[model samples]
Target: MNIHKFFANDEIATRPLHHVMRAGIFLSLIIIIFISMSGRPLAQTIEYDLKSVSVLKINLPVSQAVTIVLSDAVSKIVAANAEIADAQPITDKSIYLVGRSFGTTTVNLYSESGAPVGLLAVEVGVNSADISRSIRAALPRSDVKVNTVNGRVQLSGSVNDAYSMEKVLEIVAQYGSPSIVNVITLKGGQ
Candidate 1:
């Protein structure tokens, strides 16, 4: 097999070389398209309302939070309903908006001059992170873990008694979990 025959020298072998080149190019194009389609960016949107315009319309799960960074420095932050969500300002331009309950709330932002900046319309939904956190908070000594599998909240790990196990499940239900997987085991060991 003469490698030179496949190059510019031999005109007869050019036909085969052309087909190979086409195949390689076709494969490369397919790979590029697949890569582009597979990896997509998760976008978050800001609500632009006249009455109470929002900086972010977040569909956050309960027990979880997303950080908000404002272009203008925020002086004061207020959540419409603390039962649904809470806002904690980390800096002048950033705050951590945490989902507290299964409901909707808006966090109003203010500037240094006491002017309204924007609002964050937050909808707290069910998720494993929130459920896990809730369980841990309620029972700090319990070794329970939580995760979402196939849109269901799965609870794992060991507990000292059935009361602790039941308490963990109750917290998951309060978060409006679609389904609960109670794999929690009651053991004598801590």
Candidate 2:
């Protein structure tokens, strides 16, 4: 009877330990699940493909001109969104007239009511040297500089006004689509 009593005590002690172990395992699993869920993204990210939306390739002269003009307007719209993402300000704008002549093109940005905000004119061709010279001529006051590498031109400088940015875009548009627009990416600020 004493041995039987001892066995009963052992069983009682083991049952509590088994329950404690299961509870600990359940708690560990719950903590791991909570940590994993917390690490997931909290807010959905907003994404935009500037190139896909605005970049247009042109070859025919008239088509090139028309497309570039359209693309400029499109770029403004797409760029406005990008600007919003980048924390820049934008307003409704349009181009009254844009024309290309002798590797040079003129661009005019107008407000929604047709009031002009800026005018930019630029020249470009297959020759980086000529394009560089044209940019220098177009932006004589802005210390414009050009870099060409592997069929790409990048323009960097400080322009006195927003017109200079339009001018830079005009230059790039002359070469090709916004994606490969002479490789000339204009960076303007301050």
Candidate 3:
């Protein structure tokens, strides 16, 4: 067969190939447009209430676990520092944060469809038992109670005098926590 005749005869086959290519291009463009208009930003950082214990908080050594309740089902969790902390999914709406080291890290929670649920600012600190013991040893009979809330050292109960209250605060400050709530009341107006 002549080369020119062969090319002419195959023209119908080439037309279908062109049409398929155009369809593929159109589908790709539609997908791109749909993704861009999905309302999910390329770079999203959801800010939650750091002060709320329900959001994110943990203590070192895993003595106690912080449970986070999610509004939606969680399919995956990404810890910024695995050595500092670890997150385990208890269920679709609940997760347990276990502290590994004394440091701060961020935990990213994602949905089953890979949409971000929220970002947790996890602060892993020294164990609350150690902190409480240290405070008691420093101020004996001071009636001070140390508790950890959202990675913050909370000093509650009553103190006998201003000196004792100051000493309790000083001891808690040594831990270098990000926040300290001194809720101790002085007796005798001292």
Using Cα atoms with residue i matched to residue i, what is each candidate's TM-score against the true structure? 0.42, 0.28, 0.43
lDDT of 2 by residue, 1-190 (tens): 1111124545733345556668789999999999999998642222223234332221112111221222223223222221111111232322222122223333334444565434333332244555567777887776656544322455665567678767866876676633332332334433
Ranking by TM-score: 3, 1, 2
Whose TM-score is greatest here?
A: 3
lDDT of 3 by residue, 26-86 (tens): 9999999998899764332232342343354334433346666666677889998877778
What's the residue-level lDDT of 60 in candidate 1?
Answer: 73
lDDT of 2: 0.42
The regions of model 3 sitting more than 4 angstroms off are 1-62, 128-130, 141-190
Report how far off residue 168 is in candidate 1 (Å). 22
Residue 124 alpha-carbon offset, candidate 1, angstroms = 0.4
RMSD of each: 11.9, 19.3, 22.0
lDDT by residue for model 1 over 49-137, one digit each (tens)? 33444466677776777776666677899999998898888788777777777667788888779898787777766766666778889
Model 1 lDDT, full chain set: 0.73
